[model samples]
Target: MNFLNLEIYLDYIKDNGYRCTPQRSSILSYFIGQKNRFVTAKSVTDHLQNKMGNVSSDTVYRNLHLFKDIGIIDLTFQDGESLFHLKNEINTHEYKFICTECGNTTDLNLCPMEKMDTALNDYLIYDHKFEVYGVCPSCL
Candidate 1:
């Protein structure tokens, strides 16, 4: 995530009345500060404890939930393990391409919602859920 983008997100959170504790700021800073491939609470806690000294995993988890609630990040999971990543950049639509064998996920450029929107108008479905699972090329 870009520094400017993160500053804007934190501003949005502050405008809505979240306290923005130092731990929260540091947690957000960790996510925004790095360019990482999906991450877990333990990974973040370990790095932070090195910097802040003696932080708890519970604190990390709490901030993770806060970030999710305010839309700064998105949650993904595999094999009963949770991973967090800065939210994918916005676009006309979003797609996740998942590989079962190797347990990898890649973002796709196509926007299914365009066609789906047209069909939904006729069918009048009020909501949608989009999750597409398939083997990525490497796994194939």
Candidate 2:
């Protein structure tokens, strides 16, 4: 396990007046271990439960929300379900293609928002999220 990645999350919680508990540690470790992939709360909960036993889905969701609040992760909706991915540390902007058939994600380099700049003028935009869904090649 990379202690540095875990430390960053622990330090963030500490700086924000939150205690670092065993559960929170495990959750952060899981995300760090599986970086660059979107995962559902049930998947996380099940994995932890198999090893630790008694890990609840609610606990996972609550911790996920905290992580999102701290800007360490971002959420996307697909097929009526919520999926999570770590916030990009380098480039914060990129549109994504989400595969509905297999839940795969592909980042697109082009920014469609660029074309909307002229049409969206006069509107103050603090942030934006863009994700399109379809069957991936392998899934198709």
Candidate 3:
């Protein structure tokens, strides 16, 4: 993945009025440099502990909240726990599939549900909750 995109996200938050601190930048770099989306605060802390020395869970939570506040990322309570991922990286709604057995996520490229976005906006007047679960290739 291109770390430059993460930098863009940082610039985005700044453009929206938030200061990008070193710890926050490290956390964002960890997220962007890593391949997994199904990650937790503990994992982030562990990853940062190696190079950046140590960081508290509070710092992780606070920075995550800041990312969420700017809409560059989003959090969800799925399967039984919290999950976070960049909004723009959230493949199309139809492409979001989660594997319950392995917790792996796959992004499909087909555009079959392109119309659903508008339909949901028209009927719900905002948007509708849409998520799907299935076994991923690795799990299956």
Tens digits of per-residue lDDT for model 3, 1-140: 22337678778878888888888788778777655455666777777787588778788888877777666655667657676665544222334566777655665556544677666665653333345677777877
Backbone clashes in candidate 3 total: 0
Candidate 3 residue 135 Cα shift, in angstroms, is 1.8
What lDDT is reached at residue 34 by model 1? 55
Which predicted model would earn the best TM-score?
A: 2
Stretches of candidate 3 exceeding 4 Å from the true structure: 1-4, 89-95, 108-129
Pull out the clashing pairs in model 2.
Answer: none
| Rank ordering of all candidates by lDDT, starting from the highest | 2, 1, 3
For model 2, where is the 10-residue window of minimal lDDT? 86-95
- Candidate 2 vs candidate 3: the lDDT winner is 2
What would the per-residue lDDT of candidate 2 be over residues 28-135, giving only the tens digit for each residue?
778766655678888889878986889889988998888787766778876677988765542265477877777667877788778888889999887777888788
* Candidate 1 residue-wise lDDT, 54-139, digit = tens: 89999999888877766666677766888776654521123566565654557666777778887768687653424466677886
User: Candidate 3 deviates by what RMSD?
Assistant: 3.7
Q: What's the true lDDT of residue 105 in model 1?
A: 55
- Decoy 2 TM-score against native: 0.76
Clashing pairs for predicted structure model 1, backbone only: none
